[model samples]
Target: MNKLVTFIGNGNMALSIAKGLKNNYDIEVVGRNIEKLNKFEEELGVKVQKHLMDNFDISNKTIIFCVKPANVECVSERLEGKARVVFSVLAGTTIKKLRDNLNPEGVVRCMPNLAASVGESMTTLTGDEEYKKEAQELLGAIGPTRWLASEKELDIATALAGSGPAYLALIAEALADGAVKQGLKRDDAMAIMRGLFGGFGKLIQEIHPALLKDGVMSPGGTTAAGYGALEDGNVRSACIDAINKAYKKAVELS
Candidate 1:
């Protein structure tokens, strides 16, 4: 029999994670709205046990908390018993907040992107040292997981892996637009852009980015001209600043 995993919300992130874990675990979702919970099951394409949030007992259960960070305290008050463990996906929420509010034996802060739905999330985790192995095994089921040494490191990773998808999406759209501006048909440009990203995803796993770029840019070639244009546009500095701003915002949220 598969192990049980309880999700505390039926929102998008919860559904994404459940999509990845449904085959490996029995799912139970607790939420306030019955219709939303039912919709969650339908969207997941799997039958899941459902419970109303009011006076719910979490005793002996593993919970994947997917509620908004602002609602953590309010929701915590409604849970009736201690959880065996809680792996929270709430961005910028700390383990201390989870432990103090949710009253779990083990608390973990997990940062998983939207890619979790596809089992390709680059998840980052940190929490009580004793729960490291368990956290890794549970989260690793969905994607590659990195266990960080400190919450600070996990927070930084949140800014990167957690927010990186949106950044990449902006770049993807811009590149496609650039192609269209150069007289390439919109449909063809989009197809080529998608193919470029798909191949780059695989190649990036095997080579350093610097090495890959150096290999591509021959003297005064198209790649060189494009690379120079990107530099002239201050894209690199903007990217660096984006990370710093994002990281600081994560800290502020915490």
Candidate 2:
């Protein structure tokens, strides 16, 4: 028999997981929003039942707490001793915290980003040895799942893959804005910026940084001028600072 995966929220992450697992597993969503639940049911062709805050059946099911960090413990308490496996996607809530709250034999902490919607998410999974294999299989249904030996690495993964898409989107928007300021039409600027982003990914795939930079510099070419400007603007420092700030925030939440 297929394992039933029950999501406790109707939010984007929950929807993404449901979409990913709908075809392969028996997935059910229980949340407060009836309209959203109905829409998801119609779209995904799965069972979506309305769930009151205090009334939910979790026994024999993998209960996924997709609620906000503040509400994770509350939901966990309600599902305690009822779920076979309790998985949490709430950021800043560590495995220790989850274990303390849920007190389940199978408690897994996972961090999946927005890219899961496209099946390209970088998800990090960590938990007890007994559930590691099961957790990987469950999350792998959505995207690539890497099991970290140390649970603390989830914070770093959260900083990188969890919040990474927003940072990349901000970079894309800024690049497009710069192109627009240079007199390109908004659509045209976005098109070019999108291609440039793809090109950067390809370049990274094909060659090492030292060789790629040497090839691009070409003894004082336009590429060299652009690189010089980026260096002068302290762009590297800004990027590191952004990641550091996000990591600190994750620690604070934990």
Candidate 3:
């Protein structure tokens, strides 16, 4: 029989995974929003199951908990003894908490960024070795999955990948604004910024990040001037501070 993959929420992250797995597995999306769920079912051509907060059977399927961190314990309690493997995308909810709350055969914690919508997400997976194969099989359907032996690393991954996209978007927006400041049209500026960052991404993928920076920092060039300005503005320090703040918030929420 094909493995049944059941999603516990109909949020954006849940929708992304469901869409990604549409062709590879038997997927079901369960939630209280019947109208929205039905819409997604028709859009993705997948099964939609109604889920009430108080009653649901999760035992026979691999349950993906896509709810918020604060609501995970409540949902897990309702699914106790039903879900074989409980996979969670809730940030900062540790494996220990999940095990104690859900008491599933296995608990897998994952951090997948917004890029999952495009099947280009950088996802981090951490759980027991015995269940690693099954966890990988499920998450691999959404994007490239990497196993982190230490569960604590998921916290770092949360800050980096889970929250990284917003940081990149902020940079892109700032770049566009800078172009506008230089008297370019908004649409043209945004297009140019997109191409520049797209090429920068390709460069990082093809070469070492450090080497790419060195390559651009030619002696007495415009790139060097821009780099100098960034250093003067303490851009690196600001980025470090931002990540630190995000990590601290995750810890607090966990």
Candidate 4:
């Protein structure tokens, strides 16, 4: 029999993961609003057991924690029952914190981005060793899963994979804008930009970044000229700094 997966928050992340697991699990949603729970059920394309967060029993049920990091205390205050396990998608929130606040048998810190909505998230997990395999299989239902050794490593992964979609989206938009500036039609530019990213995504998996860069440029070619401009603009350093800053923020949030 498939296990039940209850979501503590009826928000986007909850909806996303629910979408990925709807076919496999009996889903339940708990939130502050009945209307939102109804909406969540509709969005997830399935009927769900709904309860106001203030009154619910989680004992022996798997929970996917999607509440905002700051709101955790409030949510925990309302959870009257213990959970069998919790896979928290809250960035920077640690397992110890979850255990203390939520009273779960096991706590897994999970970092999954917006792509989880499409079953393509690059999720990272870490927590109680006994639940490592279970965590991977549960999260892998939505995307690829990486089991990191410690909370520190999971925080760093959150800075990378958890926050990666927004960074990539910015680059995609900028590339399309550059094409539009060079006189391409806006629609065409967007289409080509999406195609470029699509193809590059596949290629990137099999090729090293340095090798890919070298393969795209010849000494005095257009690729080399553009590459030089990116270098001059310090884009590489900026990207490195971005990861560092995001990682630092995750640590602070924890």
What overall lDDT goes with each candidate model?
A: 0.92, 0.80, 0.81, 0.90
Q: What is the lDDT of residue 185 in candidate 4?
A: 100
Sorted on TM-score, highest at the top, how do the candidates line up?
A: 1, 4, 3, 2
Per-candidate TM equals: 0.98, 0.90, 0.93, 0.98
Of the candidates shown, which would achieve the greatest lDDT relative to the real structure?
1
Writing each residue's lDDT as its tens digit, candidate 3 over 1-254 gives 23678888888898888878888777777776678777767877766555564566766568888988898767666663556788899898888888787777788898899988888788899987777888777778777888998766878778888899999999899879987998999999999998998888778778998888998789999999888988999989998988888888888777
Instruction: Give the range of the ten consecutive residues with the poorest summed lDDT in model 1.
Output: 133-142
Candidate 2: residue 135 Cα off by (Å): 2.1
Candidate 3, number of clashes: 2
What TM-score does candidate 1 reach?
A: 0.98
Model 2: per-residue Cα lDDT over 1-254, one tens digit each: 24777888878888888888877777778776678778767877666555654666677777777888898767765653466777888898887777677665578889999988987678998877788888888888788888887766888878888999998998899879977988999999988988988798779768997898888787668888878888999988988888888888999999
Candidate 3 residue-wise lDDT at 112 = 90
Compared with the true structure, what per-residue lDDT tens digits does model 1 show for residues 1-254? 12999999999989988887888899999999999999999999999999999999999899999999999999998889999989999999988889989889889899999789888999999988887887888788779999998888988998889999999999999999999999999999999999999999999999999999999999989999999999999999998888899999899889
